[model samples]
Target: MSNLNKLDFSALEVFGRNYLKWVQDVKLHLIVKNLHPAIEDKMDNLVGEAKKANAMIFIRRHIHDALQTEYLANEDPRALWVALVDRFDHQKDIFLLEARHDWQYLCFQDVKSVNEYNSKVC
Candidate 1:
Protein backbone atom coordinates (compact mmCIF):
# COMPACT_ATOMS: atom_id res chain seq x y z
CA MET A 1 0.00 0.00 0.00
CA SER A 2 1.10 3.56 -0.74
CA ASN A 3 2.10 5.43 2.39
CA LEU A 4 2.24 8.90 0.91
CA ASN A 5 -0.55 11.23 1.86
CA LYS A 6 -2.08 13.27 -0.93
CA LEU A 7 -2.01 17.05 -0.49
CA ASP A 8 -5.60 17.95 -1.21
CA PHE A 9 -5.00 21.66 -0.76
CA SER A 10 -2.31 24.28 -1.14
CA ALA A 11 0.22 25.18 1.54
CA LEU A 12 -0.67 27.76 4.17
CA GLU A 13 0.13 31.14 2.65
CA VAL A 14 2.10 33.93 4.33
CA PHE A 15 -0.80 36.37 4.19
CA GLY A 16 -3.07 33.82 5.90
CA ARG A 17 -5.98 34.30 3.51
CA ASN A 18 -6.80 30.64 4.02
CA TYR A 19 -5.87 30.36 7.69
CA LEU A 20 -9.06 28.66 8.87
CA LYS A 21 -9.06 26.06 6.13
CA TRP A 22 -5.33 25.54 6.52
CA VAL A 23 -5.85 24.83 10.23
CA GLN A 24 -8.54 22.29 9.45
CA ASP A 25 -6.38 20.63 6.81
CA VAL A 26 -3.41 20.49 9.16
CA LYS A 27 -5.54 18.90 11.89
CA LEU A 28 -6.76 16.24 9.46
CA HIS A 29 -3.23 15.53 8.30
CA LEU A 30 -1.98 15.23 11.87
CA ILE A 31 -4.82 12.87 12.77
CA VAL A 32 -4.11 10.69 9.75
CA LYS A 33 -0.43 10.49 10.73
CA ASN A 34 -1.33 9.78 14.37
CA LEU A 35 0.55 12.90 15.44
CA HIS A 36 -2.31 15.11 16.69
CA PRO A 37 -1.56 14.45 20.34
CA ALA A 38 1.59 16.52 19.95
CA ILE A 39 -0.52 19.63 19.43
CA GLU A 40 -3.61 18.92 21.46
CA ASP A 41 -4.35 20.29 24.94
CA LYS A 42 -2.59 18.90 28.03
CA MET A 43 0.50 17.60 26.31
CA ASP A 44 1.54 15.58 29.34
CA ASN A 45 1.73 12.26 27.50
CA LEU A 46 1.23 10.68 24.07
CA VAL A 47 4.13 12.69 22.62
CA GLY A 48 7.76 11.76 22.51
CA GLU A 49 10.63 13.78 21.05
CA ALA A 50 10.65 11.73 17.84
CA LYS A 51 6.89 12.12 17.45
CA LYS A 52 7.20 15.87 18.00
CA ALA A 53 9.92 16.09 15.36
CA ASN A 54 7.82 14.17 12.86
CA ALA A 55 4.78 16.36 13.53
CA MET A 56 6.88 19.49 13.22
CA ILE A 57 8.21 18.27 9.90
CA PHE A 58 4.72 17.67 8.62
CA ILE A 59 3.61 21.16 9.68
CA ARG A 60 6.69 22.85 8.25
CA ARG A 61 6.17 21.08 4.94
CA HIS A 62 2.63 22.47 4.59
CA ILE A 63 3.48 26.08 5.44
CA HIS A 64 4.99 28.77 3.26
CA ASP A 65 8.76 29.29 3.15
CA ALA A 66 8.40 32.62 4.91
CA LEU A 67 6.38 31.00 7.68
CA GLN A 68 8.98 28.25 7.96
CA THR A 69 11.64 30.89 8.42
CA GLU A 70 9.54 32.85 10.90
CA TYR A 71 9.01 29.77 13.03
CA LEU A 72 12.42 28.22 12.58
CA ALA A 73 13.18 28.23 16.30
CA ASN A 74 10.00 26.36 17.25
CA GLU A 75 11.37 22.83 17.61
CA ASP A 76 8.23 21.60 19.35
CA PRO A 77 5.16 21.02 17.23
CA ARG A 78 2.82 22.13 20.03
CA ALA A 79 4.57 25.47 20.41
CA LEU A 80 4.62 26.00 16.66
CA TRP A 81 0.91 25.22 16.46
CA VAL A 82 0.06 27.68 19.24
CA ALA A 83 2.27 30.37 17.74
CA LEU A 84 0.55 30.02 14.37
CA VAL A 85 -2.87 30.15 16.00
CA ASP A 86 -2.02 33.38 17.84
CA ARG A 87 -0.71 35.01 14.69
CA PHE A 88 -3.37 34.02 12.17
CA ASP A 89 -6.57 33.36 14.15
CA HIS A 90 -7.51 37.03 14.00
CA GLN A 91 -7.83 36.79 10.25
CA LYS A 92 -11.10 34.94 10.86
CA ASP A 93 -12.67 38.01 12.47
CA ILE A 94 -11.35 40.24 9.70
CA PHE A 95 -12.80 37.94 7.06
CA LEU A 96 -16.14 37.88 8.80
CA LEU A 97 -16.24 41.69 8.93
CA GLU A 98 -15.46 41.96 5.24
CA ALA A 99 -18.07 39.37 4.31
CA ARG A 100 -20.71 41.08 6.44
CA HIS A 101 -19.97 44.46 4.85
CA ASP A 102 -20.16 42.98 1.37
CA TRP A 103 -23.40 41.21 2.22
CA GLN A 104 -25.06 44.47 3.21
CA TYR A 105 -24.34 45.92 -0.23
CA LEU A 106 -25.20 42.80 -2.22
CA CYS A 107 -27.89 43.12 -4.89
CA PHE A 108 -29.88 40.33 -6.51
CA GLN A 109 -29.70 41.87 -10.00
CA ASP A 110 -25.94 42.41 -9.76
CA VAL A 111 -25.35 38.64 -9.61
CA LYS A 112 -25.42 36.54 -12.78
CA SER A 113 -26.85 33.45 -11.12
CA VAL A 114 -28.23 32.28 -7.79
CA ASN A 115 -25.33 29.92 -7.30
CA GLU A 116 -22.84 32.72 -7.81
CA TYR A 117 -24.72 34.97 -5.40
CA ASN A 118 -25.15 32.17 -2.92
CA SER A 119 -21.44 31.42 -3.05
CA LYS A 120 -20.75 35.00 -2.01
CA VAL A 121 -23.30 34.86 0.82
CA CYS A 122 -21.73 31.67 2.00
Candidate 2:
Protein backbone atom coordinates (compact mmCIF):
# COMPACT_ATOMS: atom_id res chain seq x y z
CA MET A 1 0.00 0.00 0.00
CA SER A 2 1.07 3.59 -0.55
CA ASN A 3 2.21 5.85 2.26
CA LEU A 4 -1.05 7.75 1.96
CA ASN A 5 -3.06 4.59 2.58
CA LYS A 6 -1.06 3.85 5.71
CA LEU A 7 -1.56 7.41 6.86
CA ASP A 8 -5.27 7.18 6.29
CA PHE A 9 -5.45 4.65 9.11
CA SER A 10 -4.48 7.50 11.39
CA ALA A 11 -7.81 9.13 10.71
CA LEU A 12 -9.58 6.17 12.28
CA GLU A 13 -7.55 6.68 15.42
CA VAL A 14 -8.43 10.35 15.52
CA PHE A 15 -12.09 9.53 15.11
CA GLY A 16 -11.86 7.24 18.12
CA ARG A 17 -10.22 9.91 20.26
CA ASN A 18 -12.76 12.49 19.20
CA TYR A 19 -15.59 10.08 19.89
CA LEU A 20 -14.26 9.53 23.36
CA LYS A 21 -13.90 13.26 23.95
CA TRP A 22 -17.41 13.81 22.70
CA VAL A 23 -18.71 11.16 25.04
CA GLN A 24 -16.97 12.83 27.96
CA ASP A 25 -17.86 16.37 27.00
CA VAL A 26 -21.45 15.50 26.45
CA LYS A 27 -21.60 13.07 29.41
CA LEU A 28 -23.12 10.41 27.20
CA HIS A 29 -22.96 7.66 29.78
CA LEU A 30 -25.56 5.53 28.05
CA ILE A 31 -23.76 5.75 24.75
CA VAL A 32 -20.43 4.85 26.32
CA LYS A 33 -21.97 1.94 28.11
CA ASN A 34 -23.47 0.62 24.89
CA LEU A 35 -20.37 1.00 22.69
CA HIS A 36 -18.63 -2.26 21.76
CA PRO A 37 -15.49 -3.11 23.75
CA ALA A 38 -13.56 -4.23 20.68
CA ILE A 39 -14.34 -1.01 18.87
CA GLU A 40 -13.20 0.98 21.90
CA ASP A 41 -9.88 -0.86 21.99
CA LYS A 42 -9.35 -0.27 18.27
CA MET A 43 -10.04 3.42 18.69
CA ASP A 44 -7.54 3.63 21.55
CA ASN A 45 -4.83 2.12 19.37
CA LEU A 46 -5.54 4.56 16.54
CA VAL A 47 -5.69 7.61 18.83
CA GLY A 48 -2.02 8.51 18.58
CA GLU A 49 -1.85 8.74 14.81
CA ALA A 50 -5.34 9.86 13.90
CA LYS A 51 -6.09 13.17 15.61
CA LYS A 52 -5.15 15.60 12.83
CA ALA A 53 -6.34 13.28 10.11
CA ASN A 54 -9.70 12.89 11.81
CA ALA A 55 -10.23 16.66 12.02
CA MET A 56 -9.28 17.11 8.38
CA ILE A 57 -11.63 14.35 7.36
CA PHE A 58 -14.48 15.98 9.30
CA ILE A 59 -13.90 19.43 7.77
CA ARG A 60 -13.61 17.98 4.30
CA ARG A 61 -16.83 16.06 4.70
CA HIS A 62 -18.74 19.15 5.83
CA ILE A 63 -17.28 21.24 3.00
CA HIS A 64 -18.18 18.55 0.49
CA ASP A 65 -21.73 18.40 1.81
CA ALA A 66 -22.06 22.19 1.62
CA LEU A 67 -20.68 22.29 -1.89
CA GLN A 68 -23.11 19.63 -2.99
CA THR A 69 -25.96 21.73 -1.59
CA GLU A 70 -24.61 24.76 -3.42
CA TYR A 71 -24.52 22.81 -6.66
CA LEU A 72 -28.09 21.66 -6.17
CA ALA A 73 -29.14 25.23 -5.41
CA ASN A 74 -27.49 26.37 -8.62
CA GLU A 75 -29.52 23.82 -10.52
CA ASP A 76 -32.79 24.96 -8.91
CA PRO A 77 -32.97 28.19 -6.95
CA ARG A 78 -36.31 27.43 -5.29
CA ALA A 79 -35.05 24.06 -4.14
CA LEU A 80 -31.96 25.30 -2.30
CA TRP A 81 -33.53 25.04 1.16
CA VAL A 82 -34.79 21.58 0.41
CA ALA A 83 -31.33 20.49 -0.62
CA LEU A 84 -29.72 21.96 2.52
CA VAL A 85 -32.34 20.41 4.79
CA ASP A 86 -31.90 17.04 3.06
CA ARG A 87 -28.13 17.16 3.54
CA PHE A 88 -28.40 17.91 7.27
CA ASP A 89 -31.40 15.75 8.07
CA HIS A 90 -31.59 14.18 11.55
CA GLN A 91 -28.77 16.33 12.90
CA LYS A 92 -28.95 20.06 12.13
CA ASP A 93 -31.58 22.51 10.97
CA ILE A 94 -30.47 24.39 7.88
CA PHE A 95 -31.73 27.71 6.57
CA LEU A 96 -30.91 28.82 3.06
CA LEU A 97 -30.96 32.38 1.74
CA GLU A 98 -30.11 33.70 -1.67
CA ALA A 99 -26.87 35.58 -1.23
CA ARG A 100 -26.50 36.84 -4.77
CA HIS A 101 -27.71 36.16 -8.30
CA ASP A 102 -26.85 32.48 -8.18
CA TRP A 103 -25.32 31.86 -4.77
CA GLN A 104 -26.98 30.76 -1.57
CA TYR A 105 -25.93 30.99 2.08
CA LEU A 106 -26.75 28.41 4.74
CA CYS A 107 -27.50 28.97 8.39
CA PHE A 108 -27.92 26.26 10.99
CA GLN A 109 -30.40 26.13 13.86
CA ASP A 110 -31.25 23.65 16.59
CA VAL A 111 -33.57 20.83 15.61
CA LYS A 112 -36.58 22.17 17.50
CA SER A 113 -36.16 25.68 16.17
CA VAL A 114 -35.54 24.39 12.69
CA ASN A 115 -38.75 22.38 12.78
CA GLU A 116 -40.71 25.47 13.82
CA TYR A 117 -39.02 27.55 11.14
CA ASN A 118 -39.68 24.89 8.53
CA SER A 119 -43.36 24.90 9.44
CA LYS A 120 -43.55 28.65 8.98
CA VAL A 121 -41.61 28.61 5.71
CA CYS A 122 -43.44 25.69 4.19
Candidate 3:
Protein backbone atom coordinates (compact mmCIF):
# COMPACT_ATOMS: atom_id res chain seq x y z
CA MET A 1 0.00 0.00 0.00
CA SER A 2 1.12 3.58 -0.68
CA ASN A 3 1.68 6.02 2.15
CA LEU A 4 -0.42 8.53 0.26
CA ASN A 5 -3.48 6.41 0.88
CA LYS A 6 -3.47 7.32 4.53
CA LEU A 7 -4.51 10.87 5.27
CA ASP A 8 -5.06 12.81 8.48
CA PHE A 9 -8.48 13.75 7.22
CA SER A 10 -11.09 12.31 4.89
CA ALA A 11 -10.78 12.74 1.14
CA LEU A 12 -12.79 15.46 -0.51
CA GLU A 13 -15.97 14.08 -2.04
CA VAL A 14 -16.95 14.29 -5.68
CA PHE A 15 -19.95 16.40 -4.78
CA GLY A 16 -17.83 18.35 -2.29
CA ARG A 17 -19.89 17.22 0.72
CA ASN A 18 -16.72 17.41 2.80
CA TYR A 19 -15.39 20.47 1.03
CA LEU A 20 -15.34 22.89 3.94
CA LYS A 21 -13.06 20.78 6.04
CA TRP A 22 -11.25 19.44 3.02
CA VAL A 23 -10.22 22.93 1.93
CA GLN A 24 -8.87 23.76 5.35
CA ASP A 25 -6.86 20.56 5.50
CA VAL A 26 -5.46 21.13 2.05
CA LYS A 27 -4.44 24.69 2.89
CA LEU A 28 -2.78 23.72 6.13
CA HIS A 29 -0.86 20.90 4.49
CA LEU A 30 0.29 23.11 1.66
CA ILE A 31 1.36 25.83 4.03
CA VAL A 32 3.31 23.38 6.16
CA LYS A 33 5.13 22.20 3.05
CA ASN A 34 5.75 25.80 1.96
CA LEU A 35 3.83 24.99 -1.21
CA HIS A 36 0.96 27.39 -0.62
CA PRO A 37 2.25 29.70 -3.35
CA ALA A 38 1.46 27.02 -5.89
CA ILE A 39 -2.23 27.63 -5.35
CA GLU A 40 -2.22 31.29 -4.38
CA ASP A 41 0.32 32.85 -6.71
CA LYS A 42 1.52 33.02 -10.26
CA MET A 43 4.99 31.60 -10.25
CA ASP A 44 8.12 32.32 -12.20
CA ASN A 45 9.40 29.61 -14.55
CA LEU A 46 11.90 27.62 -12.47
CA VAL A 47 10.83 27.33 -8.84
CA GLY A 48 7.18 27.53 -9.80
CA GLU A 49 7.08 24.27 -11.71
CA ALA A 50 8.49 22.12 -8.94
CA LYS A 51 6.34 23.67 -6.19
CA LYS A 52 3.27 23.58 -8.37
CA ALA A 53 3.75 19.91 -9.07
CA ASN A 54 4.07 18.99 -5.41
CA ALA A 55 1.06 21.07 -4.49
CA MET A 56 -0.99 19.42 -7.22
CA ILE A 57 -0.06 15.98 -5.96
CA PHE A 58 -1.00 16.79 -2.39
CA ILE A 59 -4.29 18.41 -3.38
CA ARG A 60 -5.15 15.60 -5.78
CA ARG A 61 -4.17 12.94 -3.31
CA HIS A 62 -6.80 14.09 -0.81
CA ILE A 63 -9.63 14.26 -3.29
CA HIS A 64 -11.94 11.58 -4.63
CA ASP A 65 -11.08 9.83 -7.91
CA ALA A 66 -14.06 11.37 -9.62
CA LEU A 67 -12.79 14.84 -8.76
CA GLN A 68 -9.39 13.94 -10.10
CA THR A 69 -10.96 12.97 -13.38
CA GLU A 70 -13.14 16.04 -13.42
CA TYR A 71 -10.14 18.31 -13.14
CA LEU A 72 -7.69 16.29 -15.13
CA ALA A 73 -7.04 19.09 -17.57
CA ASN A 74 -6.01 21.50 -14.86
CA GLU A 75 -2.21 21.18 -14.82
CA ASP A 76 -1.55 24.31 -12.82
CA PRO A 77 -2.24 24.08 -9.12
CA ARG A 78 -3.47 27.65 -8.96
CA ALA A 79 -6.01 27.01 -11.68
CA LEU A 80 -7.20 23.86 -10.02
CA TRP A 81 -7.48 25.61 -6.69
CA VAL A 82 -9.57 28.42 -8.13
CA ALA A 83 -11.76 25.96 -9.98
CA LEU A 84 -12.45 23.95 -6.86
CA VAL A 85 -13.16 27.09 -4.87
CA ASP A 86 -15.59 28.37 -7.48
CA ARG A 87 -17.35 25.03 -7.47
CA PHE A 88 -17.55 24.43 -3.73
CA ASP A 89 -17.28 27.74 -1.88
CA HIS A 90 -20.94 28.48 -2.49
CA GLN A 91 -21.79 25.51 -0.28
CA LYS A 92 -20.50 27.56 2.62
CA ASP A 93 -22.77 30.47 1.79
CA ILE A 94 -25.72 28.11 1.52
CA PHE A 95 -24.79 26.52 4.83
CA LEU A 96 -24.50 29.93 6.48
CA LEU A 97 -27.97 30.92 5.25
CA GLU A 98 -29.49 27.82 6.83
CA ALA A 99 -27.52 28.29 10.03
CA ARG A 100 -28.62 31.91 10.19
CA HIS A 101 -32.23 30.80 10.19
CA ASP A 102 -31.61 28.22 12.91
CA TRP A 103 -29.77 30.76 15.07
CA GLN A 104 -32.24 33.57 14.48
CA TYR A 105 -35.06 31.52 15.91
CA LEU A 106 -33.00 30.29 18.84
CA CYS A 107 -31.67 33.75 19.77
CA PHE A 108 -33.24 35.57 22.77
CA GLN A 109 -31.63 39.02 22.40
CA ASP A 110 -34.90 40.33 21.06
CA VAL A 111 -36.66 38.98 24.16
CA LYS A 112 -34.62 41.37 26.32
CA SER A 113 -35.91 44.33 24.36
CA VAL A 114 -39.48 43.16 24.67
CA ASN A 115 -39.14 42.81 28.46
CA GLU A 116 -37.59 46.27 28.81
CA TYR A 117 -40.44 47.86 26.81
CA ASN A 118 -43.01 46.05 28.96
CA SER A 119 -41.37 47.22 32.20
CA LYS A 120 -41.40 50.85 31.03
CA VAL A 121 -45.10 50.70 30.11
CA CYS A 122 -46.22 48.79 33.20
> Which ten-residue region of model 3 has the weakest summed lDDT?
39-48
Worst 10 residues of 2 by lDDT: 7-16
* Model 1 lDDT, full chain set: 0.88
Top candidate on TM-score is 3
The numbered model that scores best in lDDT is: 1
How do all the candidates rank in terms of TM-score, highest first? 3, 1, 2
lDDT of 3 by residue, 1-74 (tens): 77657886798998998899999999998889999878875446345688989999988888899989999999
Model 1, 5-85: lDDT tens digits are 545567899988888999999999889989999999884676888889899988988889999999999998989999999
Q: Model 3: which residue pairs collide? A: none
User: How many residue pairs collide in each prediction?
Assistant: 0, 3, 0
- Per-residue error for 86 in candidate 3, Å, reads 1.1
Candidate 3, residue 21: how far the Cα is off, in Å: 0.9
- What is the alpha-carbon lDDT for the whole of candidate 3? 0.85
